[model samples]
Target: MKVVIAIDSFKGSVTSLEGSAAIAAGIRSVYPDAEIISLPVADGGEGTVEALVTASGGRFVSLEVTGPLGQPVAAAYGLLGDGRTAVIEVAAVCGLPLVPEAARNPLHTTTFGVGEMIAGAMRQGVRDFIIGLGGSSTNDAGTGMLQALGYRFLDKDGQDVGRGGAALLDIHSIDAAGALTGLQACRFRIACDVDNPLYGPEGAASIFAPQKGADEEAVRLLDRGLRQWATAAADLTGSDIASVPGAGAAGGLGAAFVGLLGGTLESGIGVALEMIELDRHLEGAQLVITGEGKLDGQTSRGKVPYGVAQLARKRDIPVIALAGSVDHGAEALNDHGITAYFPIVNGPMSLEDAMDPAGTRYRLQATASQLLRLLRAAGRL
Candidate 1:
């Protein structure tokens, strides 16, 4: 019997790798020699670095960089075993978690830390890169990151615009003279999943600005800044990135990567699957297991489990999911090659108790055991 445990992180409580390990324990209890393969996954959001490392034979390089609120923070980027490809998650530097609740505003956040992460990797002989743009705390339209990389944004006085989206509106022109020269010699891929443009009603400000603590009026100010910055980026790079697809991802960090860094935006799950060699793992497997923190209507979108399940279908492998909570639309998961879906909770428990650190592992183990038993009978293993 062959079973593969492929699950994303439980989020806030456990890691995807750790969750797979716990699930492996239960599978072992059922079939001591079940030939189980553990493949931890992430959707290019949090825990993406570890996911790439576990998925591919990737190495880590750490450095000191600016955090969300302009504070110094230690961050790391990854290099796959191929030795040439770099995997960088911007959240490692300028994510919402680093900024305190009272200080989480788009007006002041910057992607300079993200730029520093890339710059640090470029020094290590790394060339090709897969940048994961998610969970950002800024709405700077890529100006901060471009400034860090040598595309100088100057105010009317011809002086540097310091940092943040507020400064973008003061720019009269941009100078790409001092940016990282090596970027011109390498291939860059940005992993993002949004289609919002850089400005306007459904653009970066109106859609994502509020999440970064921008009030109604603040969102308007941020939107105004993006329009000016977008024009400047076009003049500097000669690329129309403002209205581009996914330009609004990570508060316009995706646009920065595409416009300033000369990178192309790609799907995060597509990148993860290729690096992990999931197609290779799916061959001849009797069953595949995948899940995330939750399964609902959104699961039909580009979530990790859904993408993995799609791959499983091509190989005629049945998929089973174990989620933190299963919603009404979960039954639809079966249409995507998932033979069955199940929730991890045992009966009804308080949302807090279900999320307790002590209870998560036990519940996951029990859930996996029950799932294995059902698969055993139906799978004829």
Candidate 2:
């Protein structure tokens, strides 16, 4: 049996890679001779670089950089096996994890560390960049990153604007000529999964800012600042990036990547698939196992599982998903090439108990056994 296992991270419990491994173990139990190709995937959110690196045989490069709150911290990005392409997760440098809950306000966070990571890689003579935009703590318009790279966000006094989203209000003009020299040889691809615009009711600040500890008032201020920043960026780069789809990702860092780094925005799942050449490998595969932490209406909106389902659909492969939880109904997944959905839970349990993690490996293995049993009865195993 040439079975392909591709699953997203289980979040808070197991990584996608770990989940795939457990599933593979169970598959082996059911059919020891089955040739299973396990590929743990991330949807351009957290853990993306590591997943791609593992699948592509890439190496990791660790570095120290400023965190969301200006404290120095150590973080790492990935180098594809070729050592030419760099995979960066902005969250590694400026994510919510790096900051305490008390300091979680978006107005205070910054993406400067992300730029520092890029600059560090560039100094090492690596240029290709794949930026993952998810799980962010900042609502800045990526102005912090621009400043780190060479764009001077100077105020009227010629002093540099301070860090955080509030600084965007002081952004008069962009002096990108000298700032981004390090990335001159770099090509950029930004992995984003949202379609929100840069500024407005459905934009970055209004939709995402509150999640990062922004109060209602803070969201309003951030929204105005983003609009102004967008206007300035357009005047400088001739791209109305603020209104662009997915530009609101990661607190408008998506806009910075596109406008300044000239990065192409794509679904996180699509980026990983292209990076790993998954489509080419999927040829003639009879079945595809794909999943994520939770499945629901959101899955219909271009999540990783949906991306995998799309590929399986094109190949007419039967696709089944195993997730930690199933939200809403399984009917929605059917349209995306998923034959059925399987939740890892076997009994009623608290959210904490389900995410115990210590017991996750066993739970996953047991679940997979059931999956095969059901499939076998259907004469498809």
Candidate 3:
């Protein structure tokens, strides 16, 4: 029998690779001769770099970069084994968690570090980029990042407008003369899931800036700044990026990538699945096991388990999901491709205890063992 295990990280407990190994061990106990293929997976969020790098036998490159508040912070990106591809997560540098709640204000935050990461990768001869746009702490319409990449945002006086969302309001023209010479040779594949536009009521600033520390008045100011930046950007790029779907993701980083750099925005999970070549490994697989930290109504929306199950469904393979916890809305997953879903916890336990790495690994093994035992008893193994 052949089995494929592609589970996501259990958040603070276990990583995707570790979880897959534990589950694989349990299945091996049931059928020692079974063939198992383990793949680490993520949905272009926090663990994207780790999942993609580890699965592809890639290496990580760490560097000191400017943080959201203009302070230096340690960050890392992945260089895939293929040598030409580099994977970066915006959250690694300017994510909300990096800022204190009292200090969380989108007006002052910046994505300059994101640009530094990309520039570091470029220095390594990496031309193919897979950038994950999620968990950002800024609403600068990507002007800060653009500034770091050699694009100058000039005020009406033709002076540099400086960094941060507030600077957007002072921009008058964009100067691309100083941009990195090798940038035109680079290709960016942006992993994005949100469809919020650049500005306005349903746009990036109005919808996401609040969570990044913007109050009511700040939201209004940031929204106005985004609108001004959008107009200026459109004039330079000749594209109306403000209205494009997902142009507001990661605080308008999506606009900078898609509108300025000519990157393509795609579903996060879809990009992950393609990067790992999940389809090639699914060939002839009789069973597939996939899951994440939790299973809920949102699981069907481009998450790891949902993406895995969709592919398995097409191949007529049964998919079993093993989650850290299962919520009420998770039952809806049955209609989306999951044949069955199970929570790893055997009994009641504190949230902290349940998140213990060793404990979670043991539970995963125990749960997987029983699941396989059941299949054997049903004459389905």
* Candidate achieving the largest TM-score: 3
**TM-score for all models, in order of appearance:** 0.96, 0.96, 0.98
Instruction: Estimate every model's Cα lDDT from 0 to 1.
Output: 0.83, 0.86, 0.92
Clash pairs, model 1 backbone: 149-179, 150-179
TM-score-better candidate, 1 vs 2? 1
- Taking all chains together, the TM-score of candidate 2 against the true structure is 0.96
Candidate 1 CA-lDDT value: 0.83
Write one digit per residue (lDDT tens) for candidate 2, span 78-179. 988888888999888998888899888988899999888888888878889899998899989888787788788777677778889888887777767677
lDDT tens readout by residue for model 3, 240-298: 99999999999999999999899999999999999999999999998999999999999
**How are the candidates ranked when ordered by TM-score, highest leading?**
3, 1, 2
Error of 3 at 56 (Å): 1.6
Give the range where candidate 3 is weakest over 10 consecutive residues by summed lDDT: 140-149
Runs in model 2 with CA error above 4 Å? none
